[model samples]
Target: MTEQRFREFKMPDVGEGLTEAEILKWYVKPGDTVTDGQVVCEVETAKAAVELPIPYDGVVHELRFPEGTTVDVGQVIISVDVAPGSGPVEAAAAPAPAPAAEPASEAAEPEGRQPVLVGYGVAQSSTKRRARKGAEVPVQEPAPAGTYYASPAAAIQGELNGHAPVAAPAAPVAPAGGARPLAKPPVRKLAKDLGVDLATVTPSGPDGIITREDVHAAVAAVSAPVAAPAPVSRETTPVAQAPVQATPVAGARETRIPVKGVRKATAAAMVGSAFTAPHVTEFVTVDVTRTMKLVEDLKSDKDMQGLRVNPLLLIAKALLVAIKRNPDVNASWDDAAQEIVLKHYVNLGIAAATPRGLIVPNIKDAHDKTLPQLAASLGELVSTAREGKTTPAAMQGGTVTITNVGVFGVDTGTPILNPGESAILAVGAIKPTPWVHKGKVKPRQVMTLALSFDHRLVDGELGSKVLADVAAILEQPKRLITWA
Candidate 1:
C-alpha cells in the first residue's frame, strides 16, 4: 500500500503568540478542491477575525474541528491531500494524518523559516525601554526567507495588534525592475480576485508596499463597479458582522455567552490599562455650530468629493491639531525603565464599536497627513472596521485615540486609555442647545468633549490644554487652517 502526502493546516499564531483561536467558520469541506492562496476558513483570535488561506493546491481530506471550537496554535485544524488522485477519502485520510500527529513545535518550525515579503516579514526593531538617547533599540534579524507557512492567514491576522506576514503559494511578483513587490497575503488575494495586477498598482503604503487601498484604487481607475473590493455603504462605526450568540440552552431563559476571542482580550486589556495607569478625565462643552457648517460645506466642495466628510472627520482633525500643540501629551509610560517616552509622530487610533467588541485601530503617521488625506484614511479605516476586515497592523502603535459616544446618542464618556497610549478623547452627541453667544441667548449646536489620560505621563495642565484646543478648533472651524 502506497502512502499519500498530506499537508496539515495547523492553527497559526496570528497574534504575537496568541495561544488559541476559535474556528468561526469553514469555507471548504472535505472533497472540496482548494487552490493555493485561497481562504478556506475564518478564525476568531483574541485580537481579530482572520481568514485562513490554504497554501497548496489540493483536496480537503478532513476538518479536525467544528465551528466555535478553540484550538491551540500549531494544532492541526484541517488536513489536505496534496496528492489527491491516489485513492478514496477514508483510505487517503487514514494514512495522511501523520502530519497532524507530529508535535506542535515541530509543525511550526519543522524544516526552517519560509520565504516572505520584505515589509510583511518579522519586525527588525521595536521601541522599548530606553535609559538614554544613545541606547541601542533592540533589533531582531529577519530569518532567511523561504519558509512555507502552515497557514498564511495566521501569519498576519490579529485583532488589536500588529504582527508579521507569512508565506503565500503565489510567486513573488515585481514590475519591470525585477524586484519583488511587498504586499500582505490578503492584499494579494484581493488583487487576484479583482483581476488587478499587484505589479501595476502604485503602492501608497509605507516602505513601498502595496495595500488593500492600492488594490481598490486600481479597480477604481478601471471604473469597474463589479470588480470593486468592498461595499459602497460608508458606515463610520463597527456593526455586528456575525451573531455573537447562537442556539440557546434548552428550557433556559438566559443564554450564556462564553467570554473568549475579541471580547476576552478586550476585557483583559481594559483591566490592565485601568489599574496600571493612573487615569484622569477632563471635560469641556463648546458650541460647534461653525464646525457643523464646515462639514456641510465640505460635502459640496470638489476637493472633498468622494471622501468621508463629517463631524467626526473635523473632530479627528481637531484632536490631531491639539496633539501637535501639546506634543508632550502624545507620549507613553515606559514602566520597565520608569521613564517617559515622548513620541514625535502620531498613530491616531479611532475607537469603533463592533459586534465582536470594541476595537481601536489607528492610522499610521497621522500627523503628517493633510486634511483630505486624513478624510480618505478615516473613510477607509471605518469602512474596513465595519466589514470586520481590519488587520492587526492597522491596530498597532497608537499614540492617542478618539471615541465618539455621540454615535450611540450618549453625551460623553470617560474612555480608558488604550494600552501604551497616553490619552483618549471622547466626543459627545451634537445637538442644538440654548447657549449664550455674542451676548445673547440663542439656540446653537453644542457638544461636550472628555479627555482621559495617564496622569503619570500627562499633567492636568497638559490634558486640559489638549481638550481646550480641540474645543477651540470646533468652535471657530478656522483654527484648523491656522493651527493644522
Candidate 2:
C-alpha cells in the first residue's frame, strides 16, 4: 500500500527579519486543493499586508489558527496531504507491516533533498506544536500500520496514517431571511473589533462583499444622532435643544489607541534619532517666484503632461541638486565604525502621513532620475503610502528625506532627522509676500526652507551649503539645467 504523506507549511519571515505577522485572511480552507506558488493566505506584518503562497501542491488538511491570530515565524500554519487517494483504499488493500523501532530522538533527519522555496526557509525535519494550556489531550497511540487517520494530531503521531483531514463545519447561519454577510477576513475582523454586525451593515464592495469603508459607515450611522430622544414638548418650558453629551462609561473619557505597527516604529526611531544625534536646524526664507513659474511651465510641458507637477516636485529637485553640489551633507554617522558613511546614490525619502501613521517611503536612486521620473516616483510613493501599501524595503536605506509641512499650510518648523539619514529638509508654505527681487521690493512667491542635520556627520558649514544651494536653485530656476 502507498503511504500518504502530509507536509506542513510554516509561517515564513515575509519581510526582512519580521518575527511575526497577524493572519489577516485565509484564501484557502481545509479540504481545498492548493498548487505550488498559489497564495493561501494574506498576513499583516508590522511592515505591510502581504499574501503568502504555499510552496507545495496538496489538499489543505488543517489551518493552525483563525483569522486575526498573530503567528510567529517558523510556526506551522497549515498542513497538506500530498497524496489524497493513498488513504483508506490503499491501506485496506495492502498487508500491515510491523512498526519500526523508535529512534532515540523523535525528530529523525529527513531523507533525500529538502524542498527549498525562495523567501520561505527550507522545511524542518520535524514540526513542533505549541502546547495548549488546559486543552491537552492524552496522546493517542499511533494507529496500527496500514490504517488511515484523518486528524492532524493522529497524523503527527506517525506517518503510517495519511488520510486528508475532514474540513470543519461552516459557521452558523444568519437570522432568517438573510444570508451570512460576505466580507474579507480583515474587514470582518475590523467589524468585529468595532462591535459592528456585518449583516446589519450595507456592503459597498463588488459582489456584496463588505469593505472597510462599509464597516466604518455602519459605525458612523450608529454613532450619529446621539440626541435621539423626543423633543421637549411645549407643555412645560420650551427649552432650546441642548447639545448631546456622551457620558463617560467607567470614567473612560479618552480612547486609548495602543501604539503599534508604523506608529510604534516611528516613535522609537524618532526618539532614538533625537537623543542619539545632535540636531542643528538652519532656516532660510527664499524668493521662489521663478521656481513657481517653472512649475507652471512644467505642468503645461509635453514631457511633464499627465504627471504631478507642484511646488513639492520642484522643491524635491532643488534638494537633490543641492545634495549633488554639497555631497558631504549626504552622509551618516557610524558610531561603531567611528566613521562618516557617505552615499553616492540618494534614496530620497518623502514623509507621508497615512491613515495608519507617518511612513517615509523613499525613491531608490532619486539623484539619477530625470524630473519626470522623479515626479512619477514621488506620485507613486505618495499614492502607495496613502493606501498603506508601502513595504518595509521601500522605507529602508534612505540617504535623506523631505517633509513638506507646506501642504498643511504651516510656515516652517525644525524637522527631525530620520534615523540613519544625515539630513532632513522641511519645506514651508509658498505664499505671495513682498520680497526684494534684483534689489527691487515686489510681491513675489516666497517660501521658508529648514534643513535639520546630524551635527556629527553634517557640520554647520555643510548643512548651510546644502540649504543655500537649494535656495539659490529655487531663486534662479535656470540653475537646475546649468547644475545638471
Candidate 3:
C-alpha cells in the first residue's frame, strides 16, 4: 500500500493588516471531499468578515482549530490527505535534520499526510510586523528636580509593604521666582492638534521641559474641542476689534482620515490601469423612450410584480447581450504570457457607492443567469455592499464592469476602467431631453452611454459597434430578440 501524506493548510493574512482572525464557521469537516474554489470557511478580521475559498482540492483529513477560536496568521487550520495513485506521495517525517532524540516533550506527529506549510510560514523572524507609519508610541521621562519617580515594580513592592509610593516633598523655593518660558513650536503644534493649551500642559521632559507627547496627551484628554466662549452682548459692544471672537482655523478644523481598504485598493488599481493601459472612451447619446415605455409596461406585468425593476437593470442586461457579439470587450490582457484571454463567461461587475467606499462586486457567470436571477443577484449584491458584508471573493475575477453614476443624480462622467478587465461601461442618467426623433423635436427619455475600452484590445470601430448595439436594444426592446 502506498503511503499517503497530508498537506496542512494555514490561514493567511488576507488583507486589512489582520493580526488575529475569529473563525466564524467551517464549510467542511473531517472526511469531507472538497474541491478547489470551494468556500472552506468564513473568518472575521478587525475590518470585516470574509469567506475564504480553498486553493487545493482534496479530502478533509483533519481540522486543527474549531470555529469561534481566534487564530493567529500562519497557524495550521486544516489537513488534507493525497489520494492513493495521486502520484508524488511522501510519508510524513521531519524534512530538516533532527538532533539525536533525548526524549524531550514535543507536539505529537499529525496522524495523516498534512500539507507542508510553505511561503510565509516556518520563519518566526519573518513574521514580526512593524508598526505602521502613523501609529503612536509611548514616551518615558524622568521626574522633575524636586519630584521623585518610582518604578512600577518599586510601587508594587511598597503596596505589599503597607506603604504606597509617594512623591518627595519639593525643596524650598528660591527668592525672585519668575514664570517658566513657554513650550517650543513642535510642542505647541502637538498641543494645538490635541486641543491642549501650552499654559495647561505639564512639562515632563528634561529640566522641566514640555515635550510634544505631553502636549499630545493633554490634548487627547480633551477629546472633543472646547466650545467657543459664548459671544458677549453684541448689541451693547462697539469696540474696535469686537473682542476678537475666537473662531476655529478653517483648514485646521478639518479632520484627516487615512486612506485604506477599498479606497486604497481602488486608487492603486486605477493608477496602474490608467497609466499602463491606453484608455479610449467613446460616448453616444440615445433616445430611450421606447425602453421607458417597455419598463412602464413591465411594471404592471404580473410576472414581474414585487421586483425592483429599473432602467439600470435593463442597461446591465443590454451590455451583457452585446458582450456576446464582441468578445474583445470581455477579455483580459496577459502581458506576461503575451496572450489576450477572451472570457466566455461574464463576471459582471456593478460599481456601487456605499457609506464605507466604492465597491464593485461582480455577479459570477451573469450571462448564464435568468432575468429574475440576475435581478435578485443584483439586489443581494447592492444590499451586501450597503451593509459592508461584500466579501473580497465576490469583488474579484470580473471580466467587465458597469458604473451607474445616474443614481447619484449625475448626467455623465468618464469612469476609470477596473484593473484586469479590457473594458468598462458607464451608464448615465435616463432623463427626459429634447431629441431628434424621426426628424422632429420632441421630449424623450434619453441617456448617454460611455464605453471606455483598452485601445490595444478593443478598437474604436468595435467599441462603437458594441455601444450602438446596446443602445439599439434599449431604444427598441424588440431588437433584443436578435441580440439575445
TM-score of each: 0.70, 0.70, 0.56
| Per-residue lDDT of 122 in model 1 | 16
Cα lDDT of model 1 by residue, 322-409, tens digit: 8889899999988889899999999999987665777899999999998899999998987787667887778878999998777666
**How far does residue 177 in candidate 3 sit from its true spot (Å)?**
62
Show where candidate 2 strays beyond 4 Å: 1-4, 31-33, 84-212, 220-251, 437-442
Span of 10 residues, lowest total lDDT, candidate 2: 90-99
Tens-place lDDT digits, model 3, residues 1-484: 2223456677888764556665645556555677787777766554345667776778765555444345678766776765634654333221111111232223432223222343111211111122223442122222222232222122222221111223654433422333322444323323332324355667778867677557556645767433322323211111101111122433554433335434566678789999988999889888889888877787787777776566766777888889888777788889999888888899999886543356678999999987767767777776676445677678779989998766545677888889899888887777899888889999998888899998888899989989998988998888767668
Candidate 2 structure quality by residue, lDDT tens digits, 378-471: 8788656544557788988999999877765688999999999999999888889998877999999888999999998788888899999999
State the lDDT at 386 in candidate 2.
43
Clashing pairs in 3: 5-113, 6-113, 6-114, 6-115, 7-114, 7-115, 8-114, 8-115, 194-219
Better of 1 and 2 by lDDT: 1
Error of 3 at 23 (Å): 13
lDDT of each: 0.70, 0.68, 0.61
**How many steric clashes between backbone atoms does each model show?**
7, 0, 9
Give the Cα-based TM-score of candidate 3 against the true structure: 0.56
Mark the regions of model 1 whose C-alpha exceeds 4 Å error after superposition: 1-4, 88-251
